[model samples]
Target: MKLVTYRHNGKTSIGKVEADRIIDLPRNDPALPDTMLALLQGGQDTMARARAVRGDYSVPLSEVQLLAPLPNPSKFLAIGMNYRKHVEEAARVGVQTPPTQVWFNKQVSCINGPFGDVHLPAVSDKLDYEVELCAVIGQRCRRVSREDAASVVAGYMVCNDVSVRDWQLATQTMTVGKSFDTCGPTGPWIVTPDELGDPHALRLRMWVNGELRQDDETGSMIHDIYAQIEHLSTAFTLEPGDLLATGTPSGVGVAMSPATYLRAGDVMRAEIDGIGAIENRVVAEPV
Candidate 1:
């Protein structure tokens, strides 16, 4: 089932998306948690309950505004240069490949709705797009082995690790550039593991306007999701709702020979096979 956070008829709630409608969980059972994080922390039993939801409390998906599925995650993390071609492209831009997983914080404050507009920061003209596969942690645990990593992940979502390149490169910590308001766009809905199957085998893509830009398979990741989970958990506990952006592939605007960054009015779309897509138009940040 696709888990979603949606707003309809002036109320927001965690919902189950099916066909062309969204099943309102809170309306069906007030016992259900009201937020995605609460639902996830409720663990398997809560998930089972959400799946068994059956009622007249559903609305056409078109009538609801979809928000970031896990809008208030404890943390939103991303792995950098985890794709070989992406690593190669980074090297071209003078960013070196790491000997170990290069992890960064996208700051939870940056979180944006699946279809929300992305801001072109007034401070920089180097805005860029990176379409990535995001894993949402379901449990609070540390030092997880790669073998057990799959069990801890709640589900997956498509994420756009929008970057303000100049600010990102101005410092070793990319958080500033990556965490600009509206920089992190994720959702549509969360596809639970059972529904998504093998995440690494899916094809992902990015487009500007209607032209294809970044296209690659999750299989191209140099460090798979399990490895990322194992590595990240080794450093700290990964709590329910924490997001792990697996990394983008090679065709980012920065890697193009002439460096074609996003401008105001540009539209960006990111999607993964089996999962759905999210499209956001770029608008300039207001003073």
Candidate 2:
């Protein structure tokens, strides 16, 4: 089932997307949590309840505005150079591939709707895009084994890990460059794990202003989702609603010959097969 957080009639609610209509869970059952994060915290029981919900309270997709499926996740983490080609591309620019998984944080405040506007920050001009397949963690667990990692995942979504190259390179920790407000665009909605089998097999593509700049398969990743969860969980607890971006494949603007960067009016369309697509327009930061 496709779960979504949507705004309709001046109010925000969580629901399930079926065809072009939304089954308003909160309206259908007052006992269900009103927010995605809360519902996720409810675990398998909540998901079962969500699946069982069937009622007349529904709205057409066009009538409601779709928000980030898990708008307020506990943590928004990302992997860097997990894709072999992306690692090779980094090598051309003097970045050495790490021996182990490289992780970074994209502050939760950076989260934006799948169709929201991405502002071209006034502070820098090296803004770039990284189309990544995001994994949504379902349960709270620590030290999860690689074999059991799949059980911890709730579903998947398309994420654009919008970056500021200058700030990123200026610091050892990439948080500053990665955390710019409105930089992280995710959702279209989250597809349950059962619905999206084998996350690594999905084809990922990103287009900037109608030009296909990034195209690759998730299978190209050196360290897949299961291993990533195993690595991260070893260090900390993986909580429900925590988003883990599985890293982007090669073909980022920074890796281009002329080093093309995002400017106002550029539209980025990031898509992953099965999960869905998210399109965000780049606009100049309001003065």
Backbone clashes in candidate 1 total 0
TM-score of 2: 0.99
Determine the C-alpha RMSD for candidate 1 after optimal superposition of all C-alphas. 0.8
Q: For every model in order, what is the number of clashing pairs? A: 0, 0
Model 2 agreement with the true structure over 1-287: per-residue lDDT tens digits: 89999999999999999898999998999999999999999999999999999957999999999999988888999999988898898899889989889999999999999999998999999999999999999999999999999999999999999999999889988999999999999999999999998898999999999999999999999999999999999999989999999999999999889889999999999999998899999999988
lDDT of 1 at 102: 89
Model 2's alpha-carbon lDDT is 0.94
lDDT by residue for model 1 over 188-284, one digit each (tens)? Answer: 8999999999999999999999999999999999999999999989989889999999999999999999999999999999989999999999999
Q: Count steric clashes of candidate 2.
A: 0
User: Which whole-number lDDT from 0 to 100 does residue 286 have in model 2?
Assistant: 88
